[model samples]
Structure formats: C-alpha cells, structure tokens
Target: MVLDIIFLMLISSTSHVSANSTTVLPAAAAACSNGECQLRDECSTDRDCAAGLYCLSCPLEFRGSRCVRSTISDPFKLLNNSLPFNKYAFLTTHNSFAIRGEPSHTGVPRFTPANQEDTVTQQLNHGVRALMLDTYEFKDGIWLCHSFKGKCHDFTAFEPAMDTLKEIKAFMSANPSEILTLILEDHVEAPYELSRLFRSSGLDKYWFPVSKMPRDGQDWPLVKDMVANNQRLIVFTSDRSKQETERIAYQWNFMVETQCECFLFSCCFHLWIGL
Candidate 1:
C-alpha cells in the first residue's frame, strides 16, 4: 500500500494576491472575523479561517472554497501501533518558528516574512509532528531567524530559540504518547551551544540518542518503544560536525526527501528514511 505522507513547506502565512503583499479578499472579511471561521465557513484567505483550517479553492466541488481542516490524523493510532518509526509518516511544518504576530525581540520592526500563522504550541496541538526551524546565533544566544546571508540581523530575528523548544518540551510532557521531531537549519557556530540549549529547555530529558540511530538503511526503532521509554524527541541538524560534537543526528544522513516544485517560494515533499 502507498501510504500518504505530508510535508508542509511554509511559504506565506496567508494567501496573497501578489508576491510582495498579502490582501484578504472581501469575501473573507464579510464571511467571518479573524479566528472565528470554522469548517465549511466561506473564506478567501487563510487569515479568515480559524486555527486548524485554511482557505482552499475547488472549482468542481462548490462555488467557492470554504474553510477546511488542515490537520493530520495520528498515524500510529490509526494504523499499526508497533511499526518501526520509519514506517510511519509525520506532518512536517517548514520554518515552523517564523510565526505571524510574534512580537519583536530586538526593539525594531520585523522585516522578515512569516511562514506560519500559528504558535508552536498550536501547531503541536494540531498534530504537526515534525518542525523545520532555521536557527542562528544572534544576540549572544541561538535564535530563530530568516536571513539572506546565513547571519541573523535584528530585522530578521524572530525570537530566542529556547522559547520554542520549551514549548515542544511542554507539549511532550503533557502528551506522553506522542513523538516529535526537530530538523534544524543550523547556523550556530559556538561549541556545545545547542547541547546547552536542549538541556536548559528540559528537552534533553526526552532526547533520542544518536547512538540508536540506524546506520545502514535499517528500520528505525518501534514508535511505541520510543514513546514508552520517553525517548520521543528526535533532533536533526544541518551541520554535520554537530553530529559528532554535539551528539545530534545529521538530517541528511538519516532522512531523504522528495520535493515537488509548486511555487517560487512554496513546495511540499515526502520524507523517508535513507541510507
């Protein structure tokens, strides 16, 4: 059987009529107030829809697109309960930390774009199991950012990375049966900084040791086992050296992706275990 996999690559927080500006259509404004739109509610943009829903257009189904649930079912709960971790799929959110309406931390207006409208907690609550974060060294600590030159400036900085990590830790603590993954586009240069962040955020408590990672295209450990042992958090870093130095897994070594081009900035893909 061909299992469906979803890899949500964030492009814009909401639908737009132009590449540089976002405008909510009149239909959305007239249909519902922000955060009030529910399933089947008429919407012209994602901002007009409530959390866990997005505006989508279907020419054949109805006259106009209505708010629809953008959620994923827990594969483990619906499918096999004891499958290898690789056998299951996750709803992966790209640039999960670049959230709209996030307050400025540098006392300057944010000049970067937002990729998501929901908070990290909300994403987790909506069943997003994997998060892709762009991390950089900023303001003497690691921060989430979207920069042009791989260096985080005040205008590009979102928030301190610890804030989001702690949110993940809290979610896992409250939901003991869930597993989460973090894929980092790492830019931190300091030694052991990520290690320190993980520890301080209390996420280290659920750390999946790199030693247990498959090395020869082998199936990952059973998801049930990972959850039962409380080793439910899997972290992957872009920097290969960090694998040995920080004891975090290198993303390329463990996961393979097949992406499809959809737009200039947005795309989706399937992630699979790789040799």
Candidate 2:
C-alpha cells in the first residue's frame, strides 16, 4: 500500500509565513518521522486536528481518527459551502397548507391526512424547505385539496392554496437567508391559473425564470447567488402545459427522477424478497 504523506503548513497565530520561511516544532511533540506534521497531522488520534476537520489515516476505512476525506463527504455540508442548488443532496421542505401531503413517484398522496402532522408554517419553522401541495378548482375558488381516486373529494383535507402561499411568502420574507422549493401536484384545469395564484400571492418576484436555467443537466446556480439575486424560490408543478409561462417550472423538466414504472417495480421486488 502506498502511504500518501500528509503535509501541514502552519503559520504563527500572530505572524505570517512566506515561501522562504520555516519554523520548527520541539522534538518531543513531533509524531511524524518525515517532519511534515505541525500541530495537526500524522496523528495517533483526532484531537490533534482542528475542530470539525477529523484526522484522516491513509488507506484503511476505519472509525474515528482512521477516517479519510478522499471518499467521504456530506453533500449538505457541500451545499452550505456554496455548491450549486442542484448539487444539494439535502432539500428545503415547507409545511404550508395542503392536502397532498407529498407523494410517491407514482404521484399518489394520502387523502386521509395520514402522516400529515405539521402545517406549512410549522414545517418551515422546523427547517422543511420542500412543499408537496395539491392544486384544484373547487367551489368557485382555487383551493388545495387532498385529491385522491381521480377527483377532489370533499371529505378529504382542503384549504385555499392562496392561504398557504401567503404563509410561504411571509416565511421567505422573515428568513432571507433560506430558500424553498414548491412541488405542486397540479390538478387545476386552467394552466394559467397557477400563474395568477403565484402573482397574486406575491411570490412572482422570487420566481426563477426559465431563461436562466441550465440546459442538458447543467449545474444550477449557487444557493447564495440565487438568494443574492432574490431568486431564492423554486416552483415546480406536475402540469407540463404550465411550464415556461409565468415562471411555474415543470417538474418533469427540472427533476431527474426515477420513472414511476421503475420505482414501482423496485418496490414490488423488495416486497417480494421481504416476504
């Protein structure tokens, strides 16, 4: 096995080190035979390294100090460090008003409020940045319904979609550093109505225009950059017809998701094996 020697370059806390400068550690505290380790390197344990940077023992995969950064990474940490939004393995969730309660790849959501404990505001307070909402035209008003079985059932959960949008708008205003993604299980007959709701809800200002989007699976803009430009919100609907108009993005175009067929097959295969 090849040992990749790690080098540590440390300058005095009160002084700067130039290319020609050299400082030596006392012989008693040095652990590295090659004389490269400073305060933190070639460690017997992780306490030698600075806070948050665990020591990486070369080659072997082990617990604690024996860890290596070559293959290990937390995408969420990367995201916080200003990787593009599309690079986030983590997402924002929103718990605004809705009956859809999120769904599977098959677009199926529970109509009975199963597992629907938090309202949209509560979800937002708890760091949820994604919202799964259902949109419908009901009773002469645009409402969010827990539509199941091919129709919006009156007995299921329901609320005005605008009310929820208001909550999201307020949250965004209060938390300027945060970002959100809206996933709509769109069932409204008029594709343009989605635009009207967004506009009226005061969310149109935060809309990310299609023209700025990267094409062909290209990288998305950085989250900080998006926030700085006030394009901190992402909206996606299942309705394809509504896309590229009034800034309501289509989910199929934006999300690289597993097809419904493949997802179902994988689930069924797992179930069969479990049995």
Q: Which candidate achieves the best lDDT against the true structure?
A: 1
- Give the candidate number with the greatest TM-score: 1
- Model 1 residue 50 CA deviation (Å) reads 12
For 72-93, candidate 1 gives per-residue lDDT tens digits of 6888789866987776766877
Which residue runs of candidate 1 sit more than 4 Å off their true CA positions?
A: 1-65, 265-267, 270-273
Model 2 weakest lDDT span, ten residues long: 266-275
Stretches > 4 Å off in candidate 2 = 1-81, 91-111, 259-275
Measured against the true structure, the TM-scores of the candidates, in listed sequence, are: 0.78, 0.59
Estimate, for each residue in 5-39, the C-alpha lDDT of model 2 and write its tens digit: 11111111222222322334233434543323343
Worst 10 residues of 1 by lDDT: 10-19
RMSD of 1: 8.7
